[model samples]
Target: MSVYQGRFEGRCAIVTGGASGLGKAAAARIVAEGGKVVLWDLNADALAAAKAETGATDVVALDVSDQAAVAAAAKASEAALGKVDILICSAGITGATAPVHEYPLDSWKRVVDINLNGLFYCCREVVPLLLANGYGRIVNVASVAGKEGNPNASAYSATKAGVIGLTKSLGKELAEKGVIANALTPATFESPILAQLPKSQVDYMRSKIPMGRLGEISESAAMVCFMASEECSFTTASTFDTSGGRTTF
Candidate 1:
């Protein structure tokens, strides 16, 4: 929230799930900070609207869960932005709200496919490009649920945990390559993703937050932009918290 004027100047980024919520918020901020972004999301209509709203350089519509689609998107993104200096993988879903004993098999797979494998695809594709440039930043959006598993939301929690692990491993691999990768672990936040959960589940998450309120988009966006900026020079493979006291470690 402090003065980050032109912090991202001349940078080009690829933001997945850029159609709504925190992803869209981060895109707008990146543009405000003098950077260009190519937005990617599954919804074509939403992608178009977000592109207009965020001043994004271009938009790609494809399901992140599809490996082929993700690879193609990365190529298209590179062509659109000329080069990618940053990648923000924020596409995910909170699948069925059922206990592990009763969870829907298909729903669980869907969540993992998008939240974990999809993100992996994006990182794997873009990392080479980042190494080629000799400098890059990656912010993988995870969740506190990953650290403190949520009951009845095993799939979501598990996938986010996988995201954290992938980011850590990636950070270490690229630490000497000038390409840094980190994960963002936000608590219960006011995101459209919440719509996927039931009210009881939402309230349960809110109660666990010491602040007794959901996180703000601006709050998380600030942390996100910081992690994706040159200011995050010394940190990689670490988890940045924006949980309003929910995560004290």
Candidate 2:
């Protein structure tokens, strides 16, 4: 049973990275609250699992970094859902943990491709569809590291920072177009993505949080739902925080 039943009675959403982690959490909430959702991820098996777990209406397996794929996904989602009301971009990577001098150029490019360019592609393809409907909400998942500049993770930090900038620019452009956009900046959170990093890297991130804890996946999902809600009106081009007191701004 959902506490906020029917908040999304007729809404439809596209949740990128919906196979797991934050994206799956958000998708589950949307479904529980009476919304239709389409899950998109890079893994077909994982996407299938998520679809069954969350009761999402559909799933699309594609890399967000692929522009043409994203374009086709937008069309497919529009066709399947009738109209897209929300876009939650939570698909990203941590890249390799290394000092700037030691960071691999290929790894940096890969991070930028998925974290920044991928988001750009999603927003680019979806915004026009939203504009046609005259209503939409977009929540791009960023990171506190983007603002604080975490040590030895320059690639992840720089690309996440780019996500913030991208959201801000899109929000402003859509201000008068009945669409809203924002970035969610989270600190060290309990996510599968964290597993990609060394334990020491994860520990360093947790140490920076005043609460000395990783944020629960549900906590971040709550914020994503709120930002994706029509109730979140009057706030665009802003960043919402789930940094466990690590970030006050």
TM-score of 2: 0.98
Off by over 4 Å in 1: 1-3
What root-mean-square deviation over C-alphas does model 1 reach? 1.0
lDDT, residue 173, candidate 2: 95
Residue 163 C-alpha lDDT in model 1: 95
Model 2: per-residue Cα lDDT at residue 230: 82
TM-score of each: 0.98, 0.98
lDDT of 2 by residue, 163-242 (tens): 99989999999999999999999998898988799999999999999998999999999999999998999999999999
Model 2 spans with C-alpha error above 4 angstroms: none
